[model samples]
Every structure is written in C-alpha cells, then in structure tokens.
Target chain A: MIKEFIRKRSIHVCLVCTGGCNGCDIEVAALLSQRYDLEQYGIYYHNNPRESDALLVTGTVAKQWQEKLVEFYNKVPEPKAVVAIGACALSGGIFQQESDKVGAPVSDVIPVDAEVPGCPPRPAEIAIAVLKYVPPTLASYRRKI
Target chain B: MSSVIWYLYEFARKTWIDRFLNAKTDPEIAEAPSRFRDFPEVQKDLCISCGACVFSCPSQGAIKLVRDEERENIFPVINKSSCIRCGFCVEVCPTEPKTLKTGENYLIMEEYRILPQEKVYIADEYLCIRCKKCLEACKIGAINFKDNVISIDQSKCVSCGDCINACPVKGAIKETYIINIDEQKEIINTLIKSLEGTINLEVERIRKLPDHDPDKIIKLEYPLADYLQKARNIIPNDEMIIKTVEKVTDRLKMNIITWDDEKCNQCRLCVNECPTGAIKYDEKIGKVERDPEKCLRCTICYQTCPFGVPGLYVARFLLKNNVILITLKPSQIPIRG
Candidate 1:
C-alpha cells in the first residue's frame, strides 16, 4: 500500500555524466522512454538541477571534468540526494587503470546517499535506489499498489 | 453517424465498464505474464537481414537462420519454444538504438545460457603464414602458430568478438553455430579436459606463493634482485634497508602502464627508467617485456610511455600485485583489460 502511494508522488531527478563512455547515460534515458515507462511511478528526469530532488551521477569523474562534477554537485539544493550509478562512478572502473587521475568516488567529493554498482547497473536497480529516499508513508503506499 | 456513435458506445462499455468489473477474474489479467523493465523486444524495421544474431545466439537453436525468399536475404527467426529469453541477441546485436526493445513491465526469467563452448578454428597447415596474427587476435591463447600452422585447442573461444574484430584479413577467422547437440557435447568435453589440466597448473603456481602478507614479496625477478642488492649495498643499516623496501614497494602499488605492439615505437625509455628494472626490452621482437616478478607496480612507466593510449585496448591491473602483460602480435593484442 505504501509503495503505491510513493509511486504517486512525483520525483524529479537530474542525471549527470562525469567522464564515462555514455553507456550508462544511454541506458538511463532508455528507462525513462516508452519501454521502461518510468512515468507510471511519477519518477521523472529533469534537465535542471534546481528543480530536481535528487541527482543520478554516472561514469568516472575524470580529472579534466572534476571541477564540473564538483560544480554540479554543489548546485543541487539541500536535502538533495546523490546516487552514484555504475562501477566507474563508484570505483573508477576500467578508466582507473588507464589514467593516473584517481577518480574521486562520489562519496569522496560529495555525500552519496546510495550507490548502484555494475559495469552499467540494470535500470531496475536504479529504480530501487531512488525508492530509498521516498517518504515512509508514500513508500508503503507504493508497496500496497 | 448513428452507427459510429453505437460503435463508440459499445467499445467504451466493453473496455471501460467490462474491464473494471472483470478485473479480478479476467483471463487476460490473470494469465498475463509478469513484465520487468529493460526486457528486450525485436524491432522488425531495423533488423538488417544479417544472420550474425542467429549464429551468435547462445540459446541452442533458439534463433534459426531463415532465408526470406521474397527479400532475397537471410534473417533470424526466433523460435519461442527454446527461447530461454536471456537477450543475448539483444546485447550482442551491433545495431544502434538496438533492434530489441525491453519494457519495464516485462519480466522474463533471467537465465544465463551457458553457450556450447565454441570450437577454436585452426588455420590449415598449408595456408598459415606463421605471422602470429591469429595468436594476437585470440584472447584465450587458443591459437598458436609456433609450428608454422595455426593450431587451435578448439576450447577457449568465448565468442567475445575479440578475434573477429582483430582479424586483419577477411576469412582468416570465422564463427559458425553448431546445430547438432552431440557434436557440441563431444567438443565441449574435450575442451573441458584440457582446461582442467591448465587449472591444475595454475593452482600449483598459486599454492607456492607466500601467505596473504601485504609486505611479503610474492614474486621476484632479475631487476628486482638487482635493485634489492643495490639497496642493500647502498644502505648497510638495517632500518635504512627496511625503509628502502617500504618506499619501493609503496611506489610499486600505483603502476598502470600498458602497451600495444601495434602502437609502440619500441623505445626503451620505460625499460631504462624503471626503478626496479622490471621492464626488459626484447629488441629482436621489437617489444618491451615486463618481468612481473621484478615490477614494483609503480605506474611511472605507464605515464612515461608515449604509446600508452587509454581505451579498451590497454592492459589494466586486475589486482594490486597482478598485472595483465599485453605483448604485440602481428595483429592486435588479445588481452581484454
């Protein structure tokens, strides 16, 4: 019941790419498209960080893009959650071996609320991580539904 | 107009009213299979009559090659009967935006189809050039042209698309699906036996290593021996010896240089600068050989090497002490880092 209620409250999320191959970003967009129908649960990806309640950061934070990452993280409003999605964002993945730039794990740079681990995590896994921030009443409602 | 109104009324009554009333008992709802997000679906329009999916499909005979006589092209005809629906066809398809579409509601049992071990193709004795192109293309070391003929163990091919992409000459490497179960099983059994022997060798090597002490030197080679000897000679004090070892070992922890023979200029800069003298240049082979035992694992060599380009091609460290050493072959290197 709580799960169903949580599904009703619209969740505006911002998606950002660090220095990754864009595989995870592409998959994340695919989830929001007609195939995954993420809209049914009122979870929507927003283009602006100001309007978003949470941020989904993908890829390894490359040295060249570290400043950009920090800026993006700081721009999001307070009580805003960050979900590091993919092995690269969490542990620098394949890129860690290629470059001297040790990618700052999301937690190292910013407070990360949750992590979705995979070369590119399955879209379903991303959805579950987002649910963690939802209010308890809404969460229970989503469960009932 | 009256007929149109009547049709609309009936459609609404049946769909809205009837569906709501019968929601619990409706066969469509009751029998409908659960769906999960990201489940793949085939897009017929984008499917280029390429039979690559059919040949690569791991679900034994689940996808069949069918000739569309009218279109004069071959296409994959997926047999629902044997389709464990693991989406191998979807994942491996070379098409952009993917011909397969997976929906959120679609839930298919996630089954990883253990593909019948692929038979490694052995180049004919008369045709092989001993160029070692196939050897470099093979990720599993299954292809060896040491005897002037490409010999394949017919076991290690995972169909990971490495050899196919690496083969410079067309027709040098080809993959074909085996339809007969008995033939596949016979080849698989033989390969397993060979793999078992290799595994035993690896286990023996691993057993000889010291217990999991981080400071204990697991492997050592000439350059490392030279460095240790030099360090001892330079610093006679026991505390200085301990400090030097600690410093060298610490530097070794950060090494990350990987080389591709195709891109390498064969410069010995990395070999010379290596503090531990871990890198040895094989001038005859026109490649740098890394002595893993001697390597301090410091990534300075990687940073210094001009040929070290980042991408899927470079060798990466799998663990703190273990490094995947990629050497040049006539073709592309086989190591997947």
Candidate 2:
C-alpha cells in the first residue's frame, strides 16, 4: 500500500549531464521554479538515483559518459524511464562528429524512453515529455482522472 | 493605538487579494520566444549527399550521408538517437534552398534507437575472373566463389571494404547496402540460390563424360602453374590477354604451392632464389609478404625451401574448403556412352 501511495503521489526525477553546453540543464531548472511550480504536477526532482523514479539526461554523450552514464543508469531503481533532453542527447547536437568526443550517443549506453529535441528545449516541453512518459497504470493516473 | 493601525496595514498586505494582484499574468516558458532553430531537416531534392553536412556536423555518426543505390546520390540521414540539434548541418549545406535547415516544427519525436546494421559488399561478376586470392586474404570466411562468381554472406560481412581494396579491377567490388541483419539474410539466401543453379549446370555437364585414361596424355583446358613458362613465352590471342596491346587479365588465382610457416626457419634463401621478386623478407620487421601480382608461379621458391615447407598444390586448391566439384572438363573426358 505504501509503495502504491509513493508511486501515485510522487515522481522523483534524477538529472544527468554528460557532454554539452548545459543549455538544456538551465531550461530543466526553470520547470520547478516558483512560477512553474512543478510540484503542482506531483513531479519531484532529486539528485539521488536510488530514490528517483525517472531519469532525465542532458548533453551530447562524450567518451567519458560511456562509463558514468551506465553507472548512474544502473543505480536508478526498477520500473524507471529514461528521458534524453536537448539536441546533444538526441544527435550529439553541435558536437556530433568531433574527434575529441566519444563515438556513442546517450541511448548507446542505457535504454531511453523519450527524447525532447531542441538546442535547449523549453520548460513546458520538458514538463510535457516527463508527464507523457509516466505510464497510465501509475497512481499519477488518479490525479489526471 | 498607532501600532494597531500598522498591524491592520500588514494584514491587508498579507491578504489573498494582494497576493493574487501581485502575480504576473503570463510568463515566457521557453528561452527564446521566436527562434526557429531546433531540429535539422534535410531537403531531399536539393541536397546532394556530398558529405559536406556530415563533415560539418560535430557529431561523428549523427549526420550521415547514406548512399541511395537507386538515385546514385548520397542522402543525408540525421541519426535522431544522438542528434544534438546544433544546426551545423544547415550552415554547411551548399545548396540554394540550404539542403539542411532547422525549424520549430522539424522535430522527430518518435521512439528511435541506433542498431548495428549489417551491410554487404558486392562484386561485379563480369569483371571478376573467379580469383580465389580474395578468399585467401580474407581473415573471416565471409566470401565464397561459385563457378568463378563471388558470393557473399552479408551477416558475416563487417563492411570493412577489404574486398574492394583486394580487387585487382577498379570498382569491381562495390561496398553497397546499409541494412539490418534480418533483411541482409533474405538477400543472401536469394543470391546463393541463383549461384547454386549455375554451379549445378557445370556439374551436370562434367558428370556426363567418361573417366580419363592414365595412358593418354591430357591437354589441360585450363592453364596450370606448369604452363607459367608458356604464358610468358607465347604471344597469346585470348580476349582476356592481348599481346599487341599487352592488356592482361591477371585476376586468375591458382595455389601453386603451400608453406607451413611453423616448420620453416626464417631463411632469406627462398627470398633470394625467387626470380620475379614475388617474395620479400623484411629483416627489420622479420615479416614476409608475397605479392601475387608479381608471382609468375615458377616453382623456384618451392624448390629452394630446404625445410620441406613447400607442398605442391593443384588448381583444385583454389576451391573453398578444397572441395573439387568438377576439375576435369568434358574435353578431358572421353564420350564412351
């Protein structure tokens, strides 16, 4: 019952930044500000992967991210969805073919469910993507109902 | 009494009406209000797969120009799985309409992934002369020949384009098709079926003739390594070899000799005895590379190997797995039946 209650009332999102300009990271921060009040949607952002239900990743996956991304992905609990935010995570953005970077993308390491593509996606777009990724079977479905 | 008026003023400021009045009516949700640059789009008609956009993009495999076999043009494929949406593909495209562009609506929101797709290398049958050298050089047993035509297993093909490099004729072997493993298997099955049909026809014709008599000398229809001297001396008039023009069809492969590297010590004696300099022993690297192009198949090196390293090989050695299906043609067989 407690597990069901936690799953329904709260969604903890863990954000990871690999290689990029961090433009998407800035937009993601705006989603939880006083004006946006992301808590109203029952989405709680956290840094710890153990407690997080959803993971949001930003930046073009560089060589270093190969090991680190998989490490963080493994830490996230079961029944979690991965979201790749911004163009870098989508297609390595401006750093796509740079030699100094690694060859793999975000999905190359872990399974990704949703992609919000933009130079830096808007807060509303990021919000919409996360909400959509939450399965209809979850307790969040009652809130929508 | 003055402090009571101040408290009433503070309560009025703290009221819900004051909070409602202070809140802004609308807020800008996005960073830029009107910027259209986001996801890059390729103009199919205007853009030539010149690799300009792929080179310009910062991501290595993100913006790829895949060759369209039908159009004979390169098509820019933006790998959405890792696209950073930096709009570099748009900036470098030289076309008038700017073959690549970024816009608010040009987003690919579908679920996507990058898989290791299998690609095949195709050899031109008309140009290939049933050479087994490519098969010998190939580290992986992905290639085989049926009746002198090359057959490839796409699943095993790593798309290394080594066959292209090994081919004597320019553009004889083409690296084509970027497809998934499932689709590649379907194409290979159909190709192998057609090749087997041609091989069976040759097999049937050879089987109809009588056995060769040991008493009578046989005039070999196909050239053998023993005929190396004849090829060098005779002014040939064959279509593949014209003496006046000196146009040579040198793609012919016959395993003239085999050497067991383990038994033989690295002696430069065999290298020195080679007439055409086909064998080269680099003392610095302690490596030996045999150039098939220069080899006349004159058994001098075979005779010089003191360690009994050389094994006499026939034309049948060219066959994959040394399976000789039909070495003796109808000419060699007497029509007793």
Candidate 3:
C-alpha cells in the first residue's frame, strides 16, 4: 500500500556534527560505502537539514552550536526524526561532569528522537540504527522504550 | 595467454556484477555480541572506600569516594564514561575479592596503566576561557591553542604545575585531580540559599542606576569550590572540609578546644601539637589548660592523643551519645563566628 511506496522512496538524512571528535562521522561515511551501500536501502545522506527527513547529530554540543542545533532541528519537515549518535549527544557522555556546560546534552536544547550510546559506534551499528530505529521514530517522535 | 583471459573475467565478475549484489543483513551486527567490550563494572558491597581506586584513577573526579549530605555514610561513584577501561582500578582494589571487577578481558597496556602514586594533569575544556595567557607562561610549547580552545597535550605536559601558577582562573589548569564543583551539590545549594539572600538584596539596591550593564552576567558561586579557589588550585584538604561540615552543622556543637584532664597525664604532647598554641600547661595551676579563643579546632589534639580517651572529640564537637556527657560540664566559652 502507501507504506510500501514510501519505503521504496529514499529517506533523506542530514548529518549534523556539533563539536564531536568526528569518529562517528567516519562511521557514517563507511555506511555509505560499497560494503554497506546505504543508497541500496533507500537512504540519501546530505549536509542540508531542510531537505532531510532525518537528522543524525554527533558530538558534544558546545554553546556556539546550541542555537544552530535548534535552527537545524526546526528546518526539517513535519514527521521528522532526530538520532543522537554518540555518548556526548545522549548524556554529554565523558563531558557529563563538566562545570559550565553551555552546549550540554542535546536533549536540553531540542527534542531528541533516539539515542545511540557509544564512544563511536561501528558502521554496522549505525546501519542497524537506520533500519531499526529511524523509521519508527519518524512515524512518531516518541521514544520507543 | 589462457590464464590472463581467465583473470580478466574474474575481476569483472567481482566488481560490476557483485557490486549490485550484497548480503541483505549486516554481518558485523550479528557478530556484535561476541566482539564488543563492556567497560568495568563495580561491586558496591565489596568496596572498602579505602582510596584504592581513587589512587588508581588517571585523573581526578574519575573515581571519587565522597559522603552524602547526611555524612553518616560514604560510597564510591565511578564515572565510567570518562574511564578509559584501562583495568587499573581492578588491579589496585585491595579487597580479598576485587571491588572494580573487569567486565570483559581488560588487557592493560603498560603505557595506559598509571601507577598507584603517579600524577596526571586534568582540565575541563569547558571551564577554559581561551585567554591564551596560559601560553605566555609555558616555555616548553606544551600548551596548544586550536579550535577556539587552549589545551594541554598530555604527552608534552611535564607536571611542573607552571600553567596552574600562571592561570588567572584557579581550576582552568590543574596538575592533580580537577576538583569539579558539581560533586558537592548539597553544600553548593546550601551556600546558595545562605549567600544568595544577602547578595540579591545588595544587588537590588545598587542596580537601579542607568550605569549598570544589562549584558554582564554575574556568575554565582554555585559550587563550594568556586568560593574557595584562589589563583592556583592546590588540592584542598577534603578530609578537613568533610569533617568540619559534618561536625558543625550548628555552631553550638563545635569543639571548645578542651582536653580531658583524666587522660591528659600532662604528656603536654597536645600542647606541642597545637599549631595555634591553643593547648598549654599552666605552671601556677600545675595543669595543662586550653585557651579556647586561640584554638583552630583542627582535631590534631584528638588525633595525636596517646590515651585515645575521646579527648579531642570533646574539644572538636560533642558526639551524639556524648552530648549528655558534655552537658554535665559547665563551659564558660561563648560561641564565636
């Protein structure tokens, strides 16, 4: 039916790196390579948020990125999803105890859809997250658990 | 010539045809359970709070043993997120059964393992205001400025504490454990209630003028450490703060700097131990006496007393059980702030 038609069409994903170490970005790159070949699964990766159906955010959000995170989060069309891609994004991770945390946990500034906790998750993890977590999140932004 | 033709067919089959064909499911995800490494897990009951893991942590606040607001209890809280999974905490825990049990195969490389007594420098980059002033003091080129952040390269840092000496902010750089103020939430909140009331009233009276800058953010000392930090943060004596804060919730219970005459034996050792000369022998009275006003209430008299006769305990603060014992004696010392 209509769901099958939507499944075949690509999910436009925007990658937003706030201030992370960029290891997760490398994993995201691997997902698009020939081994994983994310395009085959009806997915498209880009930097622009306005065209995106999903937003994948990685890194510890600094004060400078706080406003930008909200701006980008708002730009995505209705029924959009946000994937917090690393430890810093989920709970400020290693930076949790930092005093004067201006950028802080991403959830503080914008609504988060899903959290993937790892220093840097493997490419398989990211691919699995796209298959498992993203669409359900897009269906409804409420946390699955 | 036949072999060359055969290899060309194999290479074409590998790329053009197979590029379109691949496994439907990811293999690594299936193998994740076997390949992943879970960080070390702590056994709460087994831990002795002996400062073993605290000594083993590479940096401060990584493994802290602190008490709750009640001060009647103590526990070990590990920040596994900051832990490098080095297994040093597992190795050093002295209990017959280890306290920090290594979750997976914790293979410690010699370089990753910090010795029990070794020191490491730590700084929270968020606290670092990129005022490149730390650069001018360092000659070794260990301090690097990049990405709007000034940082210490652990590999190049000499642990000389020069950066700490030069920094205008006390905790901007540290040679030992970075004393994060967030850990003392109870004391900070208590201070806020006490200090805020006075400061707000004073600010309201002064801020009615047009000269007051609206954009200037007046930072509150929310953390007790923020109140105490000087030009350089030499690790403060935590035990002293913990003891004093616990004993003197109300000033009425504070140690009167008195000693037990029954146990005094007039060793006069406590007299020597008094840094402020609070304890002394009166030749005319032919007995050891204490000048309460001069007493610093450091508990050294109780700690050093050979009799172990609950001598300094009475001087420092009345114990819950001994409050009745203290009420019997008439003390003329009026409370002083």
The candidate that wins on DockQ is: 2
Give lDDT: candidate 3, residue B142: 76
Q: Higher DockQ: candidate 2 or 3?
A: 2
Cα lDDT for residue B147, model 3?
Answer: 80
lDDT against the true structure, per candidate, is: 0.54, 0.60, 0.59
Off by over 4 Å in 2: A1-9, A18-20, A59-75, A87-104, A136-145, B1-34, B48-51, B69-73, B103-337
Ranking by DockQ: 2, 3, 1
DockQ (Cα-based) for each candidate = 0.03, 0.20, 0.08
Tell me what TM-score chain A of model 2 achieves: 0.86
Question: Taking chain A by itself, what TM-score does each prediction score?
Answer: 0.80, 0.86, 0.86
| TM-score, cand. 3 vs. native | 0.42
Error of 3 at B290 (Å): 23
> What is every candidate's alpha-carbon RMSD to the true fold?
22.3, 24.8, 18.9
lDDT of 1 by residue, A27-108 (tens): 6887786655676556888989987767888877777767777788788764467888876777665454434475646677
Off by over 4 Å in 1: A1-8, A98-100, A132-145, B1-337
Q: Model 1, retained fraction of real contacts?
A: 0.00
lDDT by residue (B199-296, candidate 3, tens digit) is 33434332332221334322322233443442113335565344333333323332323344666577776666555555778988888887755654
